[model samples]
Target: MRSYLSVWRLPSAPVLLVAGFAGRLPSAMVPLALLLMVQQRTGSYAVAGLAAATYGLAMAGMAPVLGRLADRRTPRPVLLAQAAGYPLLLALLVAAVLGGAPTAVVLAASAAAGAATPLVSGVVRALWSRVDPEVRGTAFALDATATELVFVAGPTLVAALTVLAGPAWALGVSGVLAVAGALGVATSAAMRRWVPVPDGPRTSPFATVLTPGLPRVLLSGAALMLGFGALEVAVPAFAEAAGAPGASGLLLALWALGSVAGGLWFGARVVSVSLPRQYRWLLLGVTIGLAPLTAASSPWVLGALLFLGGTAIAPTLTVQNSLVGSIAPAHATTEAFTWLSTMATGASAVGAALGGALIEGPAGVTGSLLLAVAGAAVAVLVTLVPGRRPTRGRAPEPVAA
Candidate 1:
C-alpha cells in the first residue's frame, strides 16, 4: 500500500491514473448500453446483438491503425481526434436507435463509434515506461488492477443509469465520460513529453513497433481474453440453467474481485522475475482455476470457482503489460499496446459468439466452459514458444528496421 501510494505521489501519476480509469469506464458500459438501447428500440435482441458485435469488430479492426498512427506521430493527436469525434458518433448512434433508423444505419453508427473509441488503455499502459524503473512493475500491476475495477464498476454504472434514466442515457453518459478522460490524458504534460522515436527503414510492411516476442504476447493475450469471453457467456447460461438467473452478476463480480486481489498481491511482491516466465506461470494458474467451471452445477459452486479463477486475470494481464514494455521498440510503445488490445477484443468477440452458439446448441454450458479451458491452454502453449529473453529493466532497442 505504501509503495502504491508513493507511485501515485510522482508527478502526473495521479492525473494519468484518474483519467485512464475514467476513460476506460466507457468500455465496460458501452456494450451493455448498446444492447439495452438497441433492444429497447428495435424489440429484437438478434439485431441488438449484431449491433454490439459490429461495434466490437470495428474497434478491434481500427485499434491497430489508430495505434500505428500514435506511434508515427504522438498519442496526443490521435487521442485528441478521438476525444472530439467519439461522442458525436455515439450521439449519432443514439439518434439512429431512437428514430427507428434502418438496422444498417444503426450498425454503421455503431461501427463508426467503435472506430472512434478513445485509445485510453494503450496510452495509460505506455506511460508506465516513463516511470522510475524500480516502480515500473508496480505501476503496471496497479494499472491492470484498475482495469479490472473498470470492468467491475462499468456494468454496475450502466445498470444504475438504465434504471434511473434509460438505456440511451446510459450510453450517452459513457460517451461523455470517455471523452473527458481521453482529452484529459491527451493534454497532460506527461503525454506531451513522451514523444515517439521514428522507426528506421524496415523491410517488413506488417512491422510497426512490435518486436520479436510481441506476436507471442498478442497470441497469449487473445487466448486469455478468449477464455474470458467464454466465461462471460457461460456464467450467465449456467446461472439461468441452474434457475438462479440473478446470480450471474454476483458470480462475475466475484471474479473481478479475485482479479483485483491477485493484482495487488502480485504488484506488491518485491521479487525479480522475468516477464515471460511470470506470464507462463500465471497462465498455468489461470488454466487450473478455470478448468473446474465445467463441473460446477450451481451458482454457489461457480461463484467460488470463478473467484479463484479470476485471481489469475490481473496477474496475467500485469505480466503481459510488463512483457510488452520489455520487448516493444522505444518508438512504438502505444502501437504495441494497441495491438494487444486489438487481439483481445477480436478474440473475445469470437469466443462470445462461439460460447453462445455452443450453449444454445446441444453442447451446452459444459462445452463453453471446456472451450474456455482450451483457450487458456492455448495461451500456455503460445507462451512456451521460444523467443528472446524477456526485457528486464528497459525497452529493447529496435531490430535493424
Candidate 2:
C-alpha cells in the first residue's frame, strides 16, 4: 500500500493515471462496439469481422509512426492533434455505418478511425519513464493492472449502453470519452513540461529498434502475447465443450482478476533479481502454469488452472515495461514503447488465427492449449538467446526512471 501510494504522490501522477485510463477506454470499447454496430446494420458477421480487423490492423501499423512523431516533436502536439481527429473520425464511421453507406466506404471509414486512435497507451508508458527510480516498478505494475481493468470495464459498459440505447449510442459514448480523455492527457502538466530529445544520428527513425537488448525484449513480448491470444480463444472453446458456454466470460474474468492480484503483489514487494532474469523466470512460470490446462476436464478445473497461470501475466508485463525503460535509447523512448505495442498486436492476431485453425482441426482444444504453451516457451527461449552488446562510442543512455 505504501509503495503504491509513494507512486501516486509523485507530481502529475494522478492526472496521468486517470487520464491515461480514460484515453485508453476506446481501445477496449471500439473493437466490440464496432463489431456490434456493423453487425447490427449489415446483418453479416463476416463483414463486421472484416471491418474490425481492418480497424485493428490500421491502428497497429500506424502506432510506430505516430510514436516517432511524438519522439521528435514531443507528445503535446501529437496528442492534441489526435484528440481532435480521433473522435471526428469515429463520428464519421458511426454516421457512415448508420446511414447505409456502401461497404467500401464503411471499411475506409473504419481504417481512418483506427489510424486516428489516440497514442495514449504508449505515451503514458513513456511518461512513466519520468518517475523516480525507487518506485517505478510499482508504477508500471499499477499501470498494467489498471489496463486489465479497462478491458473488463470497457466491454461491460459497451454491453450496457448497447442494450439501453443501441450500438450507435455505445459507439458515440466511446467517441465522447476518447475526445475528453485525450484532451485531458494532452493538456496535463506532465505533457506540457516534457521535452523532446534533440535529434541526432542516434535518434533516427529506425535507430531505436536497433538499440542494444531491445529486439529480444520485443520478441519476448510478442511471444507472450501470442500465448495470450491462443488462450483467449481456447478458454471460450473449453467452456463450450464443457456444456456451459456462458461460463467462458466468467472464467476469463477470473483469469484477469488473478493477474491483477499478482501484479499488485509483485509491485508491493522489493526485488533483487535483474530484470532480464526476472523476465525469463516469469516466461517459464507462464509456460509451466499453462501446460496443465490440457488436463482440465470441466469449466471449474479449467478456470482454476487459468487463474493460477494468470498470476504471472501482469508481473511479466511489469518487468517487460521496466526492461524497455532501462534498455531503450533515451532519445527514442516513446517509439521504443510503441514498437512493443505493435509487436504484441500483430503477434496476437497471428496467434488467434492459428488457435482458431487448431481448434477446428484434429488438435482441438488440447492442441490450442499446447500452442499457447509453445508460444510462452518460445518467449523463454528468446530471452535465453544472447542479445547484441552495445557498440562503442554511440552507446545509448537509458531512460531515467
**1-401 in candidate 1: lDDT tens per residue?**
88787778777788788899999999889989999999988899999999988898888789878887887788898899999999999999999999999999999999999889999999888887667777888898899999999989999999999999999999989988999899888877687677567665556745753467888898888998898898899998999999999888999999999999999998888766767788899999999999988888789989999888888889889889988877877777887888888899889988988998999999999999999999999999998888765343234332200
lDDT for 337 (candidate 2):
92
Poorest 10 consecutive residues of model 2 by lDDT? 392-401
Structural similarity to truth (TM-score) of each candidate = 0.95, 0.95
Overall lDDT per candidate, in order of appearance: 0.86, 0.86
Candidate 2 per-residue lDDT over residues 239-276, each given as its tens digit? 99889998987888888888888889999989999989
Q: Specify the poorest-scoring 10-residue window by lDDT in model 1.
A: 392-401
After superposition, which runs of candidate 2 have C-alpha atoms over 4 Å from their true positions?
Answer: 202-204, 390-401
